[model samples]
Target: METAVIKTPIGYAEFKGDEQGLAAVKVLDTATVTVIPTVLQEAANQVLAYFEGSRTTFDLKLNPQGTAFQKKVWQALLKIPYGTTTSYLELSKTLGDVKAIRAVAAANGKNPLWIVVPCHRVIGSNGELTGYAGGLSRKKWLLDHESPVKQGKLF
Candidate 1:
């Protein structure tokens, strides 16, 4: 897989995959990259646009690798609106099994597409921010970035 490590507002993100589509887009503490493969340029631009608040949704071709259940969880996550959040239990129920909360959370945790899949939108049942592989602070940053109200914007 071709790889591109680019710096973002929260941290460095390593984007992986080629023309087949984006396989992964995970944050890293540090990294240096000299080239961004041609296929990933659009993904990179979309990510930057997201941080810039000029884009509310992603439209890239994704190819995240995971088990069937995990893929299902990720797909559900994509349905989460940009400024909205959902609880693990809600996701579990959506999958037709309220008892699958833990399993759903586990699959959510394994989401490989980062912001593209929006795993960060899943919060605790009581509205508290919960598990985020990219770190809670970064999760908070992303949520804040997507917030509807801002100091200057009317909408």
Candidate 2:
């Protein structure tokens, strides 16, 4: 696996992958100083575009490592609209097992693709921000960034 780190408004983002496909994307306290492979550079560019609000969707090949159930949960996450939020309970219901809320949350937490997979879009059942591996503040930033009601300028 090859790794490259790029700076973002939130923090440094590390992308891991090779010629095959992108495997992981994680926010880090510090940036990595290494030559970025072509594939990784493309991923880095996409991430930067996302933060800039110019890109609303990602189209890179992903290879996140996880169990079948976890992959299923992450795949469902991708279907969530860019500006919408869903609760763990909603996710479980979407998966055809409302009783599996906890398991669904666990799988959501383990998603390796970060913004690409969009696990941060999931909230608590009461519409509260919950656990986010990248920190709640970043999650808030991401949600706000994707808010459809953009602020209009006053003349």
Candidate 3:
């Protein structure tokens, strides 16, 4: 599998995949990877555009490997509109679990597709930001960047 690492405003991201599609996008705060290739140029561009608020959706093909429950959770996460927040309970209910809140949360955390899957949009029941593997501050920045309020203010 080919791999590349790029630095974003929020953090450094490692992109790995092959001819099939993107396999992983691991965020790291430091430079750890040896060689950063230029493969999947479009995907990298799209990621930059997303951070710049110039793109609201992604078009790259992905092949995130996860369990069935994690896949289901990640798929549902993609349906959340940009700039909006949903609770873990809400996600659980949407997935027809309603009682699988913790399980859903765990799956959400395991999502290999970051910003694209939008697990950052899921929050605690009290409307507070919850644990984000990418870091809470970065999560806040992403949410703020995509917020309709911020967009409206820019106009």
Candidate 4:
């Protein structure tokens, strides 16, 4: 399980695995790795493409570790379209348990795949941004970046 930690404009990101695939990508402020494999190269490239808005979906493979509920939330997160958002309530109902909003939100916070899984696209029922582990500011920036048309004053 070789890993590479690199500094990006957003923050320090540690990528594990090789160009054949990626296992996980962790966002950190500081970290060190003893070794890095070749697959992390492709992971880094794919992530860069995502930030550049050139990629809508990841082509790399991943084997992230999480609880079953967390995995389900992450899988649903992937279904959310780029530049769009879904409410926690919507996610709960869609998952066949409308009462699981809190559980859904918890899983969303635990999303280790970050931008790839797109936890940032989940919002409050009233359409307000909320509960982004990366912080609301970063979430807003990511959404604005992906928007097909920037919000503007109609005069």
Candidate 4 TM-score, C-alpha based: 0.86
Q: Which structure is stronger by TM-score: 1 or 3?
A: 1
Q: What TM-score number comes out for model 3?
A: 0.91
Name the top TM-score candidate: 1
lDDT of 2 by residue, 1-155 (tens): 99998888888888999888999999987776567788798898888899988999999999989999999999999999999999999999999999999999999999999899999999998999999999999999999899999778898
Model 1 per-residue lDDT tens digits across residues 24-88 = 99999888854887989999989989888899999999999999999999999999999999999
- Models ranked on TM-score: 1, 2, 3, 4
Q: Give one digit per residue, the lDDT tens place, for model 3 in 41-71.
A: 7677888899877999888888889888888
Off by over 4 Å in 1: 151-155
Worst lDDT window (10 residues) for model 1? 145-154
* CA lDDT of every candidate: 0.92, 0.92, 0.85, 0.81
Candidate number that wins on lDDT, 1 or 4 = 1
* Cα lDDT of model 4 by residue, 23-115, tens digit: 677777666633445657777777778777788887768777789989998999999998788999999999999999999999999988878
- Candidate 3 residues lying further than 4 Å off, grouped into runs, are 32-39, 151-155
Model 1 quality (TM-score): 0.95
TM-score of 2: 0.94
Model 2, residue 41: displacement in angstroms?
1.9
Better of 3 and 4 by lDDT: 3
Q: RMSD per prediction, one decimal? A: 2.6, 1.8, 2.8, 3.1
